[model samples]
Target: MPGRFFLTDPMAAVADALNVEVGVVGNEPARRNIAPGQEIVVFDGALSRMRWGIVPVGRVNARGRPVMEQIINARSETVFDKSAFEGVGRAVIPVNGWYEWTGEKRRKTAWRIAPKGGGFLYFAAITDVWTAPGGMNVPQVAAVTCAPNGDVAPIHHRMGVLLERDDLTVWMGDDLDAAKALMLPSPEGRLEISEAGDVDWDGV
Candidate 1:
């Protein structure tokens, strides 16, 4: 899974690659360590900034109790089946790569995972709007995850559902079945994973 994401690429280049407008989220500065709850660029039909975590404000469980925790990632297997995810919109999180950790907490090693040939990785995501008190609306998103591929299985048990450039439209399309079919592991050997050194964990 992508514990953290890094999008060092320029917004203009990302817009060109996705063939979409940059929209309100203009050419912002590069971010090396994008954590959950922070605003990240999201592409539904156009690019926009959205909080990386979904706050299930009024969502209730089977017993009609409030769901207190914010969701940063949703499993692909039950994303659609869950009542909590009802009315969620489809979107994509385009990033240069993501970081994963292995071993123990303090002694853990950070691994950077990216496209082998150096492009962008589009993570399938769900979008929602959380209404804060005093009538404030916050747009939010959460990445969808599936079983890890061969390259990721050794380091992590799950990985974000990545979509091909050609399949991005389908993933954001109105057809749920077509979009669900795109939620699968990226082809093995297409990603290059290595030690993530030189990253400042304390800085953005």
Candidate 2:
């Protein structure tokens, strides 16, 4: 599961890669250790980071209120059947690298999985709008995850479904079949792994 990521590219680079002119919503800075509930601007859309965990449709209060259970990652195989994802739309998240943990929890190792050429990866995702108690509504985003590929399996058992620039439209559109087809693991030799550096990304 991808709970955190880092995007070091500038807004111009992202826009240029997306082939867009200029503006995009929530243009945040490039940084490390971006956790859940943090906004990120991708090639396809600017996502208003979601709270982590999924809330079932039937999970309500005495008055039949909606709960805000959220999750950062959703299994590609089951996202279509998840109740919380009903009417969910798609979004893109551009990431340079994502981290994985190995060994014991207390003394685990952090590894970064990235493109072999040290470029960006466009991650496919599903999104929903969650309304707050009063009236505020925020978009919830969960990147689709599949079985780890040959390159990533050593560090983790799951990886985000990465898409090429050409597939963004299909993913964000109503082409269910085409979009689903893009949810496979990255091909062999598509990734590179390395130890993560300990940096105070908060200051970034």
Candidate 3:
């Protein structure tokens, strides 16, 4: 799954491609490394910024235990069925690409994955709002993951569930079954993966 993402394209391009108004996400600068817990651009219906990790403040698991950690990615197999995910809204995370690591911790190789034809890859995501002690509402999101397609299998066992441009409405609509139907692996040959050794992880 994607632990970090990149969106070097301009916000205007993203707004134009998605055919939605940029609204409050104005004049956003290009980002090369967006990590978990960082605010990211999301299109639920209109473009907006939301924290990348879902803070399960009062959520509980199926076993009735409190969800202990923040969720950066949710498994597609149980996203809808899990007790902890109930009432979450559906959204999409549009990105230029994402980074994945392989091998051991100190010897890991970084891989950059993006759409083969050079456009945005819309990741299916779930949304929520965390109410802090002062009653401030914090919107958040988590990318949904599924079994990897042939293109990504060598690098990772799972990949984020990608959505077609035409299916964006269906994924964000109120139809549960229709949204669930779109949670499959992206087809092979749709992605291009390469070694990403030049990224300045600390600068972005």
Candidate 4:
């Protein structure tokens, strides 16, 4: 699973790559350990922070967590049918790299996966808004995952879905069926992996 990631590309580069303009943000530096519930960058060429977990609408529990439960990664096979992720629309999570753990559960090793050319990966993600007490709404996101390809499977069973520039329109537009058709394991040789360095977000 792609549980953590780093988005070190400067806003300008991210905006240019995504072909969108930067919006408002509090000026946070890139994060090395992007864990659950922490705000991460989203594509729209904007810097909006979302709860890392995905909580579907109409499922908020009185206990605070969503009644439906949150998912860190949405499996590609069921994303379109699962009530949690379904035809819900799309977004991009721009990242320099994502980390996957290998080895036994007790002492797993972490590996960093990036695009073969060392450029940013425009990860495919889905988003929705959940209501809080007193009608407050919170936006949340989930990264879409698929079976790992040849280069990345050594570290994990699944990898995040990625979108090339050409596919962004299908993903971000109102065409759910078309976008779902594009959700498949990326072609072999599309990714490269290496041992992660000291967990430094800025160093990427």
Q: What lDDT score is found at residue 159 in candidate 1?
A: 100
Residues 1-204, model 2: lDDT tens digits: 576788887766766677765474436676888777666554445433454334343444445576455668889998886555677778888778788888997888888778898778888887766666686766567789999888888878898998887888989877898889888997888788888878554644
Residue 88 shift from truth in candidate 4, angstroms: 2.2
Tens-digit lDDT string for candidate 1 (1-204)? 777999998899899998978778776789999999899999999999999999888888778888868999999999998878989999999999999999997999999999998889999999999998999999999999999999999999999999999998899998999999998998898999999998998788
Residues 124-189, candidate 3, lDDT per residue (tens digit)? 999999997899999999999999999999999999999999999999998999999999999899
**What is the lDDT of every predicted structure here?**
0.92, 0.74, 0.93, 0.76
Instruction: Give the better candidate number (2 or 4) by lDDT.
Output: 4
For every candidate, C-alpha RMSD to the true structure in Å: 0.9, 3.5, 0.9, 3.9
User: After aligning candidate 3 to the native by TM-score, how far in Å is the CA of 182 from where it should be?
Assistant: 0.5
TM-score per candidate, chains pooled: 0.97, 0.86, 0.97, 0.86
Note the residue pairs that clash in candidate 1. Answer: none
User: Whole-model lDDT, candidate 4?
Assistant: 0.76
Of the candidates shown, which would achieve the greatest lDDT relative to the real structure? 3
Q: Please report how far candidate 1 places residue 12 from its true position, in Å.
A: 0.8
Decoy 3 TM-score against native: 0.97
Per residue, candidate 4 scores C-alpha lDDT tens digits across 125-170 of 8888767779988878889888877787777788888888788778
Report the lDDT of model 2 for residue 66.
67
RMSD of 3: 0.9
